[model samples]
Target: MQQGSSAHAIVVLARGRARVERSLLSSDVLPLGYRGAGDMAGESALVGMESYTENVIAMEDCDVVRVPTSTATALLRDDPALMQALVSTVLQRQAEAEERLTSLLFRPVEGRVVEFLLQAMSRWGVPDARGTVISAPITHLEIAKAIGSTRETVTVTLGVLRREGLLATAGRKLIVVDRDALAMRK
Candidate 1:
């Protein structure tokens, strides 16, 4: 959905990935975070009277299930388990967002990029013979947006990481060659 629009329902990502971004101005858009399969977006609209604060853009073709606000409210009213799950999910997302903000405010570009990579690995990586591989087509532009940096900085930092034997790329996938070294930067 478009940023700043009134949202009527919660969009649950059933498959693929999406980025939640905030438009700073006409040309600047900062990515808040990402939602993969099983993640939900627009919960604030479903539970409260707030409009969507960010734009949710599909990183890849996605499958989503929309639960209207009325139905979500009704389900929450009638089902304790569903309500609990929703609360848990919202809290987790808030925590992640806070961490991102903290990193943006205090961390250097290298640290921020390393932290972002580590977090992405934990969320989406799969174990491989050599290292953990993020089996997604993530671009330098996306990484820059996510970490509040420029694409040039990300590109240079990635080259540094590659030289340090901390990262690699296989086709479109990102491989964490030395996860420990990467995590140490953060």
Candidate 2:
């Protein structure tokens, strides 16, 4: 959550057959695109950024961290460590958003998927008996949402990458077999 950034995000789940669209404007609690289980957004207000966003923030039975601008700024001056953590979190989130925007706008779908996998690999991968494995569970739908592609597209692309020996999904993780090849797509 960045200071002075007026965006509202709520972590909600699908109640019916409605698809959840991850945006700053949507109010319906449905899983449409990238709203995974326990997904959260940190912001104060919601402005018209995109139609995918919901105006109503449906945060029921969820922990909310609401920080007033004055309080936030005061904390920044009073607590250096807390200020650093908040700044780091906001910067990382901004970087990720920029990365996703760049991939979706300038690169091909394959490149976007590859870049996403590599980023995840760098973030969550750890050495194990089988190889460098991601310790977290990630779904194809999440990958699609991250890369601005359809779920089916992510599935097909993953299949193609797997067949080419560039990537693989083992257990709850996605593994990159050839980092060079994946980077070459960039």
The top-ranked prediction according to TM-score is: 1
lDDT (C-alpha, whole model) for all candidates: 0.88, 0.58
Candidate 2 weakest lDDT stretch, 10 residues:
10-19
lDDT of 1 by residue, 57-138 (tens): 9989999999898998898989999989988988888898898889989999999999989988998999998799987678
- Residue 138, candidate 1: Cα error in Å is 1.4
TM-score of 2: 0.61
Provide the lDDT at 28 for model 1. Answer: 85
Off by over 4 Å in 1: none
lDDT (Cα) of model 2: 0.58
